[model samples]
Target: MTSGTSPQANAAAIVGAARRAASEGAAMLFTPEMCGLLDRDRGRATANIVAEADNPVLAAARDVARELGLWIDLGSLAILRDDGKWANRGFVIDAGGEIAARYDKIHMFDVDLATGETWRESAAYTPGDHVVTVETPLGRLGLAICYDVRFPALFEELGRLRCDAMRIPAAFTVPTGKAHWHLMQRTRAVEASAWVISAAQGGRHEDGRETYGHSTVIDPWGDVVLDMGEGSGLGFAMIDPARTAEVRAQLPSLANKREIPRSAS
Candidate 1:
């Protein structure tokens, strides 16, 4: 979704997407990172970045989730934490409108791009410590955000937990997205022996930032099941739990994994 600076507008978009997804027989809907509001200007964003309890986008999503009896994975929201700091938080709302799980994005996207784009994510958002996962219609779903996809250790831990599927929603820059998005996604799915579903922000947003929007889904076997390239719309793919079993039986990498010893000084 090309989420804008207005939280109300973004909320409406999420609600409409959920209704449409439910009408089409989808048990769950996944959204991109910063689905509630994406603004480069921190000062302007501060007004909309309220506590999770007061976030309109989250409130609307819960209402719609209950109304349609569908689960909605809000990719991530800019939330004002109780500690008075901010957090990049993601939510998994169950079909009953209850918050099943919440994940604070651990890996911050602090980088300088070749295109002269600089980001200091850790400057505004505090990093999360714990790894989070939950059970849903998609099986045991491991939760992660944009930059978290680049860290293999996180996915390795999720694999250790035997997650059946993982969601890594993102709002990636065009340059980096072109370079590592699909490669890293397929690798994570293959390594974990789990399905990877990533809904992404596409097109230019209201804040004048363009996202690399190839919202993708890859099966456990590293096959591309769905790729919504540079588009903003809902796409679907069928997931077979047996496929995960098949891949694990064939590779068994997770089973064979061992801790690597530190290099001798």
Candidate 2:
């Protein structure tokens, strides 16, 4: 979604997507990072960034989820933490409109790009310190956010937990998306022997920032099942749990994994 600075507008987009998804026979819907209110301006964003209970976008999504009887993986929202900091928090609302799980993004995107774009994510958001997963219609779903994809340790933990599918929603920079998006996603799926479903933010947004919008899905075998290239819309793909089992049986990487010895100085 090309989520803008307005919480109301973003909520509408999410509700519409949920309706469309349910109508299309989808049992679940996944969105991108900052699915609600993607305001880069910290000062301006402060007004809209409220606690989770008070967030209108989340409320609307919950209401719609209950009405439609659909599960929604709301990619991530910028939430005002109680400590006066912020959190890039993702929510998993079950078909009953109840929050089944919440995962705050652990890896902060602090980088200076050659494209002249610099991000100090840790400056605004406090990182979370837990690996979270939940059971859904699609099976055990592991959760992670945008920049978290860069760290393999997180995915290793998800693999160790034997997640059936993983969600790595993002609003990626154009340069990095072009460079490592598909490669990293496929690698993660192959390494874990799990399905990877990544919804993404696409197109130019209201805050004058452009996002690389290739919302994609990769099977356990690292094959691209869906790629909604450079657009702001919903897409769908079928997942087979049997395929994950098949791949694991063939490679057995997870079974063969042994604790690495400490590196010598």
lDDT of every predicted structure (CA atoms) = 0.95, 0.95
lDDT of 2 by residue, 87-161 (tens): 999999999999999999999999999989999999999999999999999999999998999899999999999
Model 2 segments more than 4 A misplaced: none
TM-scores of all candidate predictions against the true structure: 0.98, 0.99
Worst 10 residues of 1 by lDDT: 231-240
Q: For model 2, what is the error of residue 17's alpha carbon versus the real structure, in angstroms, after optimal superposition? A: 0.8
In model 1, the runs with Cα more than 4 Å from the true position are none
Question: Residues 89-115, candidate 1, lDDT per residue (tens digit)?
Answer: 999999999999999999998999889
